[model samples]
Target: MATIQEIKIDLEEKSMRTLLSAGTNKDCKIVAEGDSWFSYPVVKDIVDHLRQMGYAIKRHSKPGDTLENMVYGTDFGIATQVQRANNYGPISLKETLRSVKNLKPKFVLFSAGGNDVVGSELAQYLNHKRSGLPLFRENFFRDSVNGHIKSAITAFLEQVWQVDSGIHVIMHGYDYAIPSGLQYELAGIRFAGPWVLPAFARKAITTRTEQNRIIRQLVDIFNELLISLSNTYPNFHHIDLRGRFPNEAQWHNEIHLRKEGFEQVAKLFHQKMVEILNYNPVA
Candidate 1:
């Protein structure tokens, strides 16, 4: 059995080659889009592993994309806007379908909606709970959030089908983020985070354990929404990644996992893809 470090190094090496040779091979193109989770090394490692097993990966993810819009770029602070200038010109649902008009893809991996609720929106949700508004009014905001996410997902799926009715989509609900407030130190760039932890503090939910529970509940709501969508779409599959990293050490901060943690998550995604598609690509 390969050690975690060995697995990581191999994935990293393959990722560089696969990325460099992107769009060159057309035999086994797979499109993956969504948020930072898919844009970062987590899903990239999975793509690398898949490519090593004979697959060509085409990615459409951005670092801070939500269900409806792609964020401009890497805005390290609390992200408030979902719509922004796509400086990177990411392949969105529209672009994905357009790309596939010429050539069909086997699978689409999507991870989104986490950003829509995490920052100021989260604070608003909590504030609504404290507001003296009628029960129906409070429910309106919560329901609207879920409704928007579900509708966006439906639209994306419909577009995929319009391009190729046979395309399979693989999506995952995010794991519960630890309220660590740890600073990010990847390569040379640095950013401070654990955005939820600070947000909870600002909202007067200062107790760490209580904060964890509240955040977990919030995450559950989103996951349930995803599950419902999965049931509705025959080709859309949802992987529950809520507890993949249960400990603090596995996390880099609030929303992201460390490399080992990311590897585990990616392996789950890879395993699910192989199981569903029965993909046995020639190496």
Candidate 2:
């Protein structure tokens, strides 16, 4: 496996035309964007694997960015908070646009919006009746969450299509996350999340079994939304990762994966990319 440093060298040395070339010196220019999922070693492994197969890559993923920031603007006050947990700085939609215009990639790999729904928005979906509050608010999905996500995705893609309608946008629906409140220790600080797990406990959704169900419901909603968008947009392709990793061992923390875990998921992404692009560098 090549280090991120080595991958950086490849990204810098490759040109857009050469990256798009195929059959002789086979290569494809891929713009990788999104969340900590892509910022981690999982995406690193994916890029390295693609490089070994002769694909040139340029990654613009930010470790703690959400779809809002990536498309709208940076308003997440916690942007500076999790620096130690995942080190890449914020990259806004404007910055992403700048790259798209400059690089003219064949495909844009995006992974985001998980943070938006995972944090405070999750509580709205829960049945808080055990706390003497009302049951699940039926209007919450339509009035708040769904429209917000749909609009963000629509606008994000609209902007990308405007840049170049030829660019195929690749995105994935995250696999279900356990409400385990698992923490990973790095540099003496313990970073554990989905964050909603602890939030669930605070709000009296105490049972692990119940927490898991609620979390799964939330994951399903988001994944369904992605699928719907794929159906709506011609250039957009969605990869459903719902059942890709069934074992709990795949999740390092509540929201992240271990190295081998990332490798497994990366292979899935690679397979889907090859299928959509119809150009297999490995072959």
Which model scores highest in TM-score? 2
Give the per-residue lDDT of model 1 (tens digit) for 1-283: 9764466466556644654564644435677777767555332344444545565566666665666564223324333586444344323656666656654667777777777766435666664324454212236445855677677777777778888898888888888877777645555566434567667666666667766776777778778887887888888888898876798877766787765665676677667767776764432
Per-candidate Cα RMSD to the true structure, in Å, reads 6.4, 5.9
In order, the Cα lDDT scores of the candidates are 0.65, 0.69
List residue ranges in candidate 1 displaced over 4 A. Answer: 1-27, 41-54, 70-91, 128-141, 187-189
Least well predicted 10-residue stretch by lDDT in candidate 1: 70-79
For model 2, give the 10-residue run with minimal summed lDDT: 82-91
Question: Model 2 scores what on Cα lDDT?
Answer: 0.69
* Residue-level lDDT for 38 in candidate 2: 72
